[model samples]
Target: MNTPELGWFKSSYSSAQGDDCVEVAVTEQSVHVRDSKDVTRRPFTMDLNGWAQFVTSLGSN
Candidate 1:
């Protein structure tokens, strides 16, 4: 996928030191995720519904 075209952004909680940075970009049907430090790697993609469910699950932990 053309990750750069998607305008990925890191979490607001991300620090300037750049550790543990998770970058994400929202598209109409899917959400793209990648490690900010090694963006050249292929990203993980999930459907919107799955992304929502995953986020909800994280909140429960």
Candidate 2:
């Protein structure tokens, strides 16, 4: 399925470090992420709930 267009934002956690990171945009249907350096590439996306779980899991690291 084609991803809906979104205005992705970079993670605040990585802001101080500069642009070598991924940016994200979350909508009601899914969360989209793409390499900041390569906006033209296909982004990775997951269902909202699944993305939430993934974010939660990241905090444990």
Error of 1 at 53 (Å): 0.5
lDDT of 2 by residue, 1-57 (tens): 234468778877786766788888888898898887677788997998999899899
If scored against the real structure, what TM-score would every candidate get? 0.87, 0.76
Off by over 4 Å in 2: 1-4, 15-18
Candidate 2 TM-score versus the reference: 0.76
In model 2, pairs of residues that clash are none
Q: Please, what are the lDDT tens digits per residue for candidate 1 over residues 1-61?
A: 4467897888889998877899999999999999987888889999999999999999999
Using TM-score as the measure, which candidate wins? 1
Candidate 1's C-alpha lDDT?
Answer: 0.89
C-alpha positional error of residue 40 in candidate 1 after TM-score superposition, expressed in Å: 0.5
Minimum summed lDDT over a 10-residue window in model 2 is located at 1-10
lDDT of 1 at 34: 93
Model 1 vs. true fold: TM:
0.87
Per-model clash counts, in order, read 0, 0
